[model samples]
Target: MSNTPRTLFDKVWDAHVVRQIEDGPSILFIDRHFIHEVTSPVAFLGLQQRGIGVMFPDRTFATADHNTPTINQHLPVQDPFSANQLKALETNSSKYGISHWGLGNPKNGIVHVVGPENGITLPGMTIVCGDSHTSTHGAFGAIAFGIGTSEVEMVLASQCIMQPKAKKMRIAVDGKIGKGVTPKDVILYIIAKISASGATGYFVEYAGSVFENMSMEGRMTVCNMSIEMGARGGMIAPDETTFNYINGREKAPKGADWDKALAYWKTLKTDEGASFDVELKYDAADIEPMITYGTNPGMGMGISNKIPVAEALGGGQASFEKSLQYMGFQKEDSLIGKKVDYVFIGSCTNGRIEDFRAFASIVKGRKKADNVTAWIVPGSHIVEQQIKEEGILDILTEAGFQLRQPGCSACLAMNDDKIPAGKYAVSTSNRNFEGRQGPGSRTLLASPLVAAAAAVTGVVTDPRDLM
Candidate 1:
C-alpha cells in the first residue's frame, strides 16, 4: 500500500483495478452486475452472437421491472415488445445459470430495490447496472455506477470494465434539517444550487452530520439522484447504520463470514488527511420541501418560493424561458396552489418503506381529491409486503388510494403507468425532464410528503403545512 492517505472512492477503486493500461482506461473488476429486462436483452443477444458465455453468472442478477406493468401483473403483458423483452430476460438468465426474479415471483421487483433488500449490495463492492440509478447501491459505501450496453456485455464476458477513473467530489451538509424536509428535498436543494451539470466527470462522496444521521433508505434516495447533477455516482462511508441494515438479510454474510465481512467494512472510510478534487458544503436548515417547476431536476426551489426571473438565474435565458413555457408557467410564478392532475409515489428513488410511511402520515385522515389521479406503487414485492404489514396500505385505502404492484412505474414512460399529455403530476420519482413521465406531460418532482399533500388537496401545497 502507498503511504499517501486515500479517500473512500480511492480505497475501493484501487482494490478493483485488474490492469492499468498506459495512458488509457484501466480494466476494473466488477463485484456485482445487476441487469433488467430492458438493458440485458440486447447484451445477452450480443453474448450469444459472439459465442461467449458469462464469466461469473453467480455475480450477475436479473430482474424484470422497467417494462413490466405495475397493474395486472398476473395477466399477460399487452405490449408485444415488453412481453418479448421479459421472456428474453427469463430465458437468458436460465441459460446462463444466473439468478432470475421475474414478475409473480415473491422476490421480483425493480432491480435496484431488490438488490439491497436481499443483501446483494454490500460495502466496498464495485457494482454496475444498465440503469443510471445504479448509484443507489453506493449508499453502502460501494463504487457503483451505470454502464452502457456494450459495457454490460463486456462485464458479463470478462467480469471487467474498461474505464477512466472519475474525479472525486465531496458534498457535506451540516446543521439540523427542518420539519417536512426529506432526503429527496435535500438532494433537490443541492442539485438546484449546483445546476444540472455541476458535477460532471466526478464521483461524489456525501459527508457531514446530515448524511451520517440519515437512514439507509434515505441515504439510498440521495445517492440515487447523484446522476441528476451529472455525477458518475454518489456514496456515503459505511457505519453502524449500514451494518445494521444488512445484518440478517437474505444472502448477507453470517456466522464466521459475518464477522469477517464486518471487519473489512469498518475499513471502508476516508482517511483523515485524504482530499477530493472538489468540495462543497451546505446548511441543512437552508433546505425545505422542494419541487421542480421546470423541465429538469436542477430547475427547482423551495415549495413556498416563487420561480426566479430569467435574468436573475443567469445562463441560457432563452432556454430557461422555454422550459417555463413547456411547463405552462411564467417567471416569478408561485408553485403553490397550482392544480395537480396526478400524483405518483414510487420509483427506485422514493419507493422504499420509509417513503410510504411519510406519504401515509399526510393522508392518514384525509381523502384523495376527486380530480387527482394517484398511483401508489411500491418499488418491490418486499416493499409491497412491508406496506401491508405496517398498515400503510390501510391508510392509503382509507384515503381513497389504491396500491399498485411493484415495478419501475411512471418514473419513465416505458410501461403502462404513463402520465397523460398536458396533465400536471406531483411525483416522488427522480427527474422532471420534458415528457419524462409521458409525452407532453408536465412533471413536478417532489418528496413523498409533497405527493401525498397534492393527492389530497388537488394542488401543490407545502407538506409542512399538513404536518
Candidate 2:
C-alpha cells in the first residue's frame, strides 16, 4: 500500500472516480445503487419525463420495501399510498430495464438489508440512495451517502455522481462497554455529546478500541446514523468482521475472486499519520443508557437523568422549549419513568436479527406490560426468516410481543402502525423529529434494550434496571 496519509474513504472514492475537475468535486463512479419504494417514484418519474432509461441497469437495484407491511406482504397492500408507491417503483424498474425484487421474491427486503445480505455491498465501491440512512452500506469500506431526487436522476442516467470531498472527522472511543451497553448506546452518547448538527457536512470515521472490537452489525448500527449527527456519511475500516459478514453471501465474490477481494480490502484503512478535519475523543465507559426527551434527536439524556432545565438548555433553549410543549413534557421530568402507550423495535437502524435476538433475550421470560402495545418489525424479510430460524419469534410471542411484518413500520409511520396523538412511544428507529412516528405522535428514541425494557414494563426504563 502507498504511504500517503490516506484514509479508507479517500481510497475507495479515488478508485471509483474517473477524473477530478479543477476547483470542483470529483465525479465518482457508482458500483451499486439501492432504491426503496418510497423515494424512487419521483426520481423515476423525472427519468420518464425526460424519456431516458437507466444508464447502467446492472448497477441499479430496486426493492418494494419501506412501505410494504410486515405482517401480510401479499397482493394488494392495506395502505393505498404504500401500494401506489410500490407499484410505481415496479413499473419504473420494468420500463427502465432495471432489476427489482418485489414482495414475494426471496431476495426482497429493506433496501439496505437486501444489499448487504445479497453481497452486493462490498468494499471499495461507491453507493448512493435517496434515503438518508443509506450510510448503512458504508460498513463495507465503501463511500456511501444519500442524495436528492434530482441527484438520483443524475445517477440513474450516468452511473456517476458529482460529489464534493467532505471534511473528515475522527471520533475515537476507547475502552470496553459496560454490561448491557450496546453500539446503539455508543452512538446515542456520541450524538448527545456532539449534538445533532455537530457533524453537519462532514464524513465521520469511527476509530479506537471500541470500534476495533465491534462486529459488523455494530458497525452498521453506527454508520446508519451518520446523518443523525448531520454527517454526510460514516464508516469504519474494513476488517475481519466486515469480510466475514460478506463472505458466502449470494452476490459475493467466490474462490480466487474472494481472495483478491480480501487482499484489496485489507489495504483500506487509515495511514498512521493521516490527519482529519476534526477529531474528538470519547470514553466508552462514560456512556449511559440514553433517551430522547424532545422532538429532535439530539435532545437526549441518560435514562437515569431528568430532562434538562432551561438554564441547562445551552443555545437551543427556544427550540427545546417548543419541543417540550409539543411532547407535553416538563423540564424536571425523569425520562426513566415516563409512561408509554406503544413500544416499537425495528428499523434499518436496529431491525437486524442480532437486534431481535437482543430484544428477545431481555423479554423472553416476562410478559408485555398490561397496557402497552408492542410491535417488533424486522428490517428485511431475510431478518424475519432469521428470527424464525433462530426461534426468536416464539420467544417474543410468548412474551406477548406481536411480530409485525417487515417494513419500516412505525419508524416513520407511512403505514397504519402509527401511535395515536397524545400517546407516547419508545422506538428503536433512528430519528425523533416532530411527527416522525406519525402526524402529532410523540416518540422517544432509545436503544433496542431500552425498547425491550419498555415493552415489558410499559414505561421508559433503564435496561440496567431490567437486568
TM-scores, in order shown? 0.99, 0.97
Give the Cα error of residue 368 in candidate 1, in Å: 0.4
For residues 1-467, what per-residue lDDT tens digits would candidate 1 score against the true structure?
A: 67789999999999999999999998999999999998888898899999999999999999999989988899999999999999999999999999999999999998889999999999999999999999999999999999999999999999999999999999999999999999999999999999888898999999999999999999999999999999999999999999999999999999999999999999999999999999999999999999999998999999999999878777699899889999999889999999999999999999999999999999999999999999999999999999999999999998899999999999996998889999999999998999999999999999999999999999999988999
Q: Lowest summed lDDT over 10 consecutive residues: which window, candidate 2? A: 309-318
Kindly list the per-residue Cα lDDT of model 2 for residues 403-424, writing each as its tens digit. 8777788988887888888889
- Worst-scoring 10-residue span by lDDT in model 1: 309-318
Model 1, stretches more than 4 Å misplaced?
A: none
Best by TM-score: 1
